[model samples]
Target: MLDKVKELNEKFKTASPQEVLEYFLKTYKGKIALSSSFGAEDQVLTDMILKQDKSAKIFTLDTGRLPYETYSVMDNTNLKYNIKVDVYFPDAKEVETLYKEQGINGFYESIENRKRCCFVRKIAPLQRALQGLNIWITGLRASQSITREAMHLVEYDENNKVIKLNPLLLWSEEDVWDYIKTHKVPYNKLHDHGYPSIGCAPCTRAIKEGKDIRSGRWWWENPEHKECGLHKK
Candidate 1:
């Protein structure tokens, strides 16, 4: 599987994002899925994927702490595409346990607490979403942040035990926005207010101009420790 991922990466190295998505949508068929957060990059992928295959499997995790703007975009996306994106939620039992173990908003007290909250709310549900899947598509780009710089267009996710495909891995910030504007893709309104990255409301904030896009996410933690365990390197 690892060797095949390398081969696919090399094969699609020069292909457009749309072409890359098209091939995987047809080849993988029902086994492939895209995990979107409705950010600019994901919106671009959502537009491209649905345009090619309206029945493509695209899903999002509702952490119960997302911003209103995120919901707005989600609603707008469904309206525009006329397709309801599948949604996953953290287990109610687990969420109740989380609150008992660490009081509500405990994630802000320390990095450990933050990671625990993230694991319960995001990672665990993501694992459920990825079950019975062969290909896991993401909206990640190499230039988005330092943690993702080492990622390839295609790689094997040992944790999820699935072949991961990053169709926009080589895209730049300008490239993402260019595609969005030209395609009239619906995006999170927070992006216009200085948020380059959007995540759960409590954990995300807006970055200043010329700053790293992902700086807004988990701003309290070091760049090396910023991941929420979804896309582990």
Candidate 2:
């Protein structure tokens, strides 16, 4: 799988994002899926994938603590595309135990607590969402943060044992917005108010204009520790 992913990256080095989507959507078919977060980049991918294949799988993880705007855009996306995007949620028992152990917002106290919260709310649910899949599509861009700087167009996610496809890996922040506006894609309202990166309501915030796009997410932690284990290398 690793060798295949390397070959794929080489083959699509100069391909357009749509071209990448078209090939994966047809070749992999039911064995592939896009894990959307309903952010600008993901919204763009959703439009491209649906345009090529309406039956293409696109899913999102509902952390249960997401902001209202995230849900709002999610509904708008479903209406616009006329397809109900699949949603995955964390285990009820795990969430219950998390609260008991952390007391609602214990994530603020330490990195361990925060990671624990993310595991229960995001990672665990994501693992379930990726089950039995050969390819996992994402909206990750290299410029988003330090953690994502070394990502490739296609790579193997050993954590999930799937070929991770980053269709928008090389897209710029400007490129993402341009695609969104050109396509008139439904995006999260939070982006209009300075939230460059949107996640669960409590974990995300609006960043200053010049800050890193990912600065808004997990703002309390160091840049190196910002990731929630979803795209862990």
RMSD of candidate 2 to the truth, in angstroms, is 0.7
lDDT of 2 by residue, 40-81 (tens): 999999999999999999999999999999999999999999
lDDT of each: 0.93, 0.93
TM-score for candidate 1? 0.98
Clashes of each: 0, 0
- What C-alpha lDDT, on a 0 to 100 scale, does residue 72 get in candidate 2? 94
Task: List ranges where model 2 is wrong by over 4 Å.
Answer: none
lDDT of 1 by residue, 186-231 (tens): 9999999999999999999998999998999988889988899999
Best by TM-score: 2
The ten-residue window of minimal lDDT in model 2 covers 211-220
